[model samples]
Target: MSASRTERLLNLLIALLNTKYGLRRSELRQKVYHDTTSSEVAFGRMFERDKGELRAYGFDVETVTDKGWGSDDPATTRYRIGKESNRLPDVSLTPAECTVLILAAQLWEQAALGSAARNAVRKLQAAGGLVDPELPPGVQPRIRPAGQAFEDLVDAIHSQHPVTFSYLAGSTGQEEERTVEPWGLGSRFGQWYLVGHDRARSDKRFFRLSRFTSAVVVLEHQTFAPPSSFNVREQLAALPELPVRYAVVDVAAGALLGLRKHARAGGDADDTGAATPVPDCVDRLRVPYRDAETLAEELASYGPKAVVVAPPALHAAVRRRLAAAAAFAAAPFPPIDFPRSGPAKRTRKRTSEDQLKRMLQLVPFLVHNQGLHISEVAQRFGITRKELEDDLRILICSGLPEGYPDDLLDIRWDDDHVYIIQDLDLNRPVRFTVDEACALLTGLEALNGLPGLAEGGALESVTLKLMAAAGEEGLKAAAVAGPDVAPEDSAVLETAREAIRGGAQLRLSYLAPQRDAVSDRDVDPHRLYSLDSTWYLEAYCHSAQGLRNFRLDRIQSLQPNGRPVSSAVDPAGGFPVKLFTPNDDDAVVVLELTRQGAGLADDYYAERTAALPGGNHLAEVRFGSADWLPMFVAQHGGSVRILQPANLADATREWLDAALARYEDSTARQLD
Candidate 1:
């Protein structure tokens, strides 16, 4: 019987680790390969692949060859992993430091780094270097890497692979293909950017993730060495801010108050002379803008309520977006293949590589937690009891080349409790992977911006200790990306936390964008949590008689009433995983999403989704209020289209058509 790949790799790792003088290729093949049917050439190929895999897993497989006779001959080379080089050194951290580290590691909410951070923290816990501590109330901070492109770029940067993507150039307003040797990725000015060597231009450049028009494709077969001192944060910081420009617009009275607040009356002869005629209730104003595309998106969202009069470029951009939205709204819905069994539950496939990584960490964890229940061990590793048992069976059969009873890993279970009698020098945790280090370090830095999370310089002390443990490579990888939270929001965040801690209700003057008004409301403080860079307060609203989420930035004023909370509702367990809390009264709307906008389904927490042709999706989403449905459709340009609910589809089409019609006369004049 042929041995499974997991068993083969385990045997190979054991053989290599136990060797003192390093074993020759022929000897390693003879010792590790249980299947005798394979040819010598095939065994050689498999051995080479296994060696590379081990190296990738952070093992330093050293090659040793005799100098006297065939020093340069591949046949004479022997391989072994140095124990001192491969093992993680002891890390001693204080309880306070452990608390801060745990928060830092959990900062990546749903990004690729989130899992990496969890694994890193688990390893630290296994090594007895981390003590689980209670988190601060009403102070949860999270950073989300934009999308799949952000994740793909991170992987490319780690592997030093070049990537190709279509990017819309903000400067030229053109879409172009770019092949870049990804150096680092970081968030700056509330946007994620990739700093890399552009192969076409043969110069370093920064590309914004939001500007990417296509999926990132990594050229794994090709790789390059980035400069050792390359830092993502520094490169992003050096980027010059875009020169701000102004747009003249006519906004209807009592409409788009958010826009009017940042705008001033436009009366200059040059600006007003070029302005198109507006109704008596409309006010002409000049609004400062940095990026025309970004401003255009915002203006398009207002539908016919706001019109860009001057800055022909901005006006034209807005008109184009509105026209596209209107065209999509009026178009026929695509055929959708709904699943009869309902939406498929998300499942993660456990590959051999995943299992091997888990086993490596599992050994050290079991060493620290002796006689733990088998079910508990399986739960900790996010696997089933049967899976854990299978792993244990495989481990017991793996050992040194001699395969003696004592030489193998001794795993015993009694009364549903599991214990590792011998770990074969794997009791110590392995060093952090690059992604794990980056996730943790970036998260810690983000927490630095939040007020009063850690005190007595514990945060800084922990950061320094982690840097030392991460080594040079880990530091370089971590430097590629970071998260930034606006420090200005700290005051409001502190106030909300205070209210929650004091068990007092808060009287808040909050801006309701949908209603275009600022209203005062009293609410019992629940919790303060942040998703990405935005902080939200989940509270029980007295006005609405239910739970509501208020943006900290939009909170005009907050004063704690000093009265004890009256609500009987407990805010402990119902913390939302998504920004929107679906209510029974929420309108169930169906929509179609283009390939570019398919991520919106996940963002909005769609109730059901069906696959359509051309990379589009049919989603059934719940809207708290459908008042903003038109804006949502227009804001996404033509990427989103309202499908079902005949009234909504017609309303969105009419809204977009009216917005586009406002530019008709100006467009005609230009053509003449």
Candidate 2:
């Protein structure tokens, strides 16, 4: 009544034409008009008038009143707009978003970190109407290049077109001739690099397109063999953070390097071979691997030569192995377990109704394969259609990522029923593999044996289901469930789950190993988080006057203490977790070591090594935290030297002093 309903009909018809099917008059009336029942006669008159008007605008509205084509369903009478060859409607993304998406596509086309970048690229393509649904968020590219070369290269690579270009290799003012078979593209070290087979060398090589002169595709045909079974991400991630040798690689030097020259893995050479002085053909060791064992071995080979850069875990592992080798040939034996201590111990979150409630609570999303019918889902789960549909509805709405841009509810609906939009087979459900099932079942069995968990049989059922899904082979892994971790001493964790449920405060004596102290703290427990097989109470901690991660394994004692937290507390803001606590005095303990030390620097729990010297071709590792200092020191076993910071130096010296004191006292006693 307010606007021209006739014009609106034509517009709707135009939009509908893009889909595979079309609606008849009554269906159109039902979809577009709020009260279509009353407009039945008017709707019919408008439909014919609209068809005539649209035909004038060059829309071919073919009528189907003839013989076999006549609709028996009666919904085919409405005129359908022929496909629009002129233009498509504008998409939902802003220009800025579109630009980002295009760039993401550029990155996607050249990505070696395939899975990691897949979603972002997919989402970008989705925004560009290239892909469907969307991908989740991920770590932003640390290397943000402000050039269009990356984009252009992606197009050329994807199109499989040939491009002529010149690239400056080094300071010799020499330009090499190269025609390449583009394999992939990737970003590294704040610049973009392309991986392709060098036509000149008959080998795979990397080219920095930004450095190439007159790089443009002149070839029209796109035909080339893509590299088989090669992952770009793995190759690129293998690059060293910093070079031990010169960043530049001469033919002889590169050939001598032990690290394999992956198409795009490294930016500089290592100095592992640099110390030879006489300079045999090459001047560096090969790439330091990410695998803990391989990295340990590599670091050991370097002994004191290679420098490790990037990622804390790898560095720690190398340092750990080196320290262990220095201290002892074998790992220290585990602490002795006391005889069947107290009564039975229960699982932290092992409950039936609780698990069901959680499942229900988290059900709204996670359904991606949309083609599954409700009946099929019911059959697969051996449940009634009602229950299955309810589960599906929950999955249709359930997920994290606040508000739900990433929510997996792609259900398409007509006036009568709902249909999930899936391109693949809907009958198949996402399931765990044999190994994964085994791991899950093992965890489930461990949970079953835990104290308090015996009261709930849900975990057992889940385990059975997982095993059944994986079949007999999976049961073997589950059967191999081994010894459980002993409960931590000096900390008795009592989860305040009931307290949070019933609105009560908990009194706790938490062990603070940093200060070698255990203090009484009052907490209003809200939640319990299970991470890496340990429970932690996430609640309002009154001891620190804030929230804290109270390790369930580390609770020395627990009792009822205070009332529920209610004083205008922010639900979102709470105590930030420090990875580890410090001991008595803060120590700026600097560790001086070889390139292996540089590699090991990544494994630190605290801040970075200050004054990192490339000059020495070694790493100066520093630590200032007290948390787990003794344990960390013990693990390292003394290949590392404490450079400065008086207190930590004293601590190191004190360890040596105590060892010396033990030896002297033992000798005296023996001599006497």
| Model 2 lDDT tens row, 1-672 | 112343253234333453344555665565544344565667667666766654543346654443456654355443454453211222344333333333232222111212223322222232233323222111111112222344345455545665556664533334666677666564444334667777787887766543453334435564675665444444555655543322212123333133333223443323342221212443433343423333434443333333233233444444544454444322232222222432121112233322232222222212332344556544433345665555444444432212234333345433323355421111122122232333344334434333333343544544454345445434333222212222232133334555665677788877654453568888776655332234566666665565556777567678776566553443342222222233344454445433223324433332333322331111233344533343344333443445445465455445434433433432353345
| Candidate 1 per-residue lDDT over residues 132-178, each given as its tens digit | 77777876777764766777888999888999999988777778999
Q: Which candidate leads in TM-score?
A: 1
Q: Could you say which candidate leads in lDDT? A: 1
* Every candidate's lDDT: 0.80, 0.41
Model 2, runs deviating above 4 Å: 1-431, 451-453, 482-495, 529-540, 550-557, 566-624, 635-664
Clashing residue pairs for model 1: none
TM-score of every model versus the real structure? 0.89, 0.32
